[model samples]
Target chain A: MSVAEKLIALDPLALRADFPILAERIHSKPLAYLDNAATAQKPQAVIDAVTEYYTHMNANVHRGVHQLSERATAAYEGAREKLARFVNAASPREVVFTRGTTEAINLVAQSFVRPKLKPGDEVLVSTMEHHSNIVPWQLVCEQTGAKLVAAPINERGELLLDEFEKLINERTRFIGIVHVSNALGTVNPVRKIIDMAHARGIAVLVDGAQAVPHARVDVQVLDADFYALSGHKMYAPTGIGALIAKAEHLEAMPPWQGGGEMIRMVRFDRSIWNDIPHKFEAGTPNIAGAAGLGAAIDYLEAVGMDRIAAYEAELLDWATRRLEQVAGLRIVGTARDKAGVISFMLDGVHPHDIGTIVDTHGVAIRTGHHCAMPVMEFFNVPATARASIAFYNTREDIERLAAALEDCRRMLA
Target chain B: MDLKDLYQDLIVDHNRRPRNFRRMPDANRVAEGFNPLCGDKLTLYLKLDGGTISDVSFEGSGCAISVASASLLTERLKGATVEEAEALFADMIPLLTGKLPENAPREHFRKLAALEGVKEYPSRVKCASLSWHTLEAALKNAGQPVTTE
Candidate 1:
């Protein structure tokens, strides 16, 4: 069988066993965790890797010459290299460790875009970007006197490519796009977006926080100027993520922060900055998180990203079809391409009520604006109850969600 | 933690057809309450007469708990003196936060006690108390938005 068929045929229940938390019982019911878009449950391998790091190689990286520090440094740098390969970046140097995708975007906004922008210059973004992608640009625009322009999305939540192309003009300096919308699960045509931006001599930053967990991202293949992702959303620990950017941009951009390890030689008069990745990493990093993220990359690689993507596609399709059967239920984003996210609303039932009622059945889903309030405004909803799937989720989980939703409808009605 | 406790018939009824859910064109005091966590928002309008709430209403969108609590607040506040409303606020804050004294008399709360089950869900406490906080802002005549952080 081909790899796609092999992955599609894999026993999801067996894969579920790899995540120890999947066995947890909530309110005397088996846990049905469908909130992967918020953060994924870590596998045992990632947990062990984090535990092993603290247990054995618990030392500061890149500074100490001691044996523990050397081991720690090697492990941490090895993680950067692994992530570099995982995203198919040109070099590990292009991957700068960050607190998470939010911080990575903030860094790019402050260092790369802020200085280059002039008054009245426009930073283009989609209507479906998460707040992390929107707010930093707004802040930078506030400081630089630039304007943040939003490219509209269609009623189906897909980007209006023609309108987006129209929004890009001489005044547009940067384009920030979400690879997969956290609220809508719309897998944006990022490669096409990048090509369009590059043709106009504009830079593009892709928020891969929601995409990296669901699909393989090749920064080189996309020719993206900068890409950001959160490790926590990909079955790794929190407080660790990366920004992979082109070498030229990294070199051209001034360091966002000034602190130890990021500086090469400091003086009362002037300070020399460190290299590309290290210059951006200002403080003692999340060493344990890096180790866990490394193991997460390894775990994903072992299972194969292609397989995970294919399997999640199946799950997304199944969930879409299953959720459509419910009366008065509206699926928010019906983009031709999507990730493993389903944001829906039951008529006359508030999302918060849906969330609470569903939790009675031990079905965990996210119910809120999902940090994408603009998208909610576009859909004219205060919030949505989102059940985002992962590789370990089964059709049984979808059934549980549908049943819990029905219970919510019945109770609310 | 029981869903039944949280979503009582009273709450559902109030949420479905909230009492006093309209703009008061002749309002003396107005305050906006926003719960950023869930995007719940409410604009409270009150017409005070000689330290008494002569008329009160609210218009906004929020979860069931929020809308119900706001609806219930409006129903209880009408004809109540500012002092009595303030006292009720003092009593209601502790009750919703699960800090009510065990020996505290329940009769003072009356119908508003329907929201007591919200204490079981710590995250829902803000949803239940958002309007109360907004009411406090309106009573103080605070000209800024209130947030249930």
Candidate 2:
């Protein structure tokens, strides 16, 4: 049988047993954690890796001649190698450790974008990008006297490729787009974006912060110029992320930050910087965080990305159907393709009230602008209550969420 | 507490048919207040006479709590001396904050007593206080004009 068929054969209830925290309760009720897109729950493997690092190899990496330092360096570099393989990069040298996707995007914007851009030169981004993607490019453009351009999305939250194509011209030097929108969960055609940008000789940066945890992300297969993701959004802990870029691009860009480790040699007169990945990675790294991320990737690979994707797809469909059945509920972002995000507004109740009422019933969901104010503006609503799911979630969770919404509506009305 | 207790009958009555809620054509000081967090907005028009509040009016959009607070405040503070209005403002804060006991200042507060239930909800404190806070700033500005949050 095919792998897809085999994955479909496995029971998701059996898979839920692996996530220990899912069994816990909140507010005197069993936890119905539906806010996976904000940050995922860490698996035991990742937590164990982090604890084991502090317990045993508790030394700063890459500088000392002590045995502990050597062990720390090995573990840290080993994690980098694991990440490079996981993302299908050409070499580990092309991957740079960052605080998160926000810092990764800022690094590229400062080093690569600021130098190449001239006044009136345009950097194209989509309307659906997170504030992290939009604000950094805006600051870069403002600082360099360049202009920032936005490609508008359709009413259904899908990126209008025709609008994106029209926005690109001789003045356009780069295209920064999100692989999957954090607000709408609309998965863009990133491969096509990369190909189109390549044709125009414009580099493309894909914010894969949402995509990496849920989807099969082969950076090599996508052929994106730059791909950024946050570890915390995956099963890994925060304060560690990776930026995957082409080697040639890295060579051309200057160092974003200057510090001890990123330099090769220093004289009184001048200093020489280190090569590719090290140039971007300055000072002491998040060694423990890297180990945690390595373990998270291992846990994900064990489950198989295709299986997780398929399971999440089924969950999303169930949630969409169930939520739409509520009398006064209106689901936002009904794109032809989407991930496990359900943003909706109840007819008479404010989203904050909805969140409060839902919480009383033990279902935790995110409300308000959700750090995507512009998308809320696009929908012509002040805010929305969002319930985002993951592979660990079940159909019962969706039912709980739906039932809670009904109760909340009646209470508010 | 129940929703009716939270959004009391008095509050619903005030919201549905507000008193002293028209724009004052002969107002001396007018200011707009916006609570970005909840998206509640209001504009207050005050007609001051020397150190006394001569007349007060308001025109804007907001929720039941904010609208009722404004309507109740207008009735309490109109024709009162500036010092008395300030004293009333002073009493209202702790009363609405639930720092004072339920019957601590009930007879004095009268109609303004309706908003006493707001203190239980920390987030809605801003919503209940939006109009009153703006009125305080507007009065202070009329007393000695300056900038405020």
TM-score on alpha carbons, each prediction:
0.97, 0.88
What pairs collide in candidate 2?
none
Candidate 1 CA-lDDT value: 0.93
* Candidate 2: tens digits of C-alpha lDDT, residues A178-291: 998888989999999889999989999999999999988989999988999999989999999999999999998989999988999989899999987988888999999999
Give the alpha carbon lDDT tens digit for every residue of A234-271 in model 1: 99999999999999999999999999999999999999
Alpha-carbon shift of residue B1 in model 2 (angstroms): 9.4
Q: Which tens-of-lDDT digit does each residue in B78-111 have in candidate 2? A: 8877788777777888877778765665677888
Q: Can you list each candidate's DockQ?
A: 0.73, 0.24
- Model 1, C-alpha of B135: deviation from truth (Å): 1.5
Model 1 CA deviation exceeding 4 Å by range = A1-9
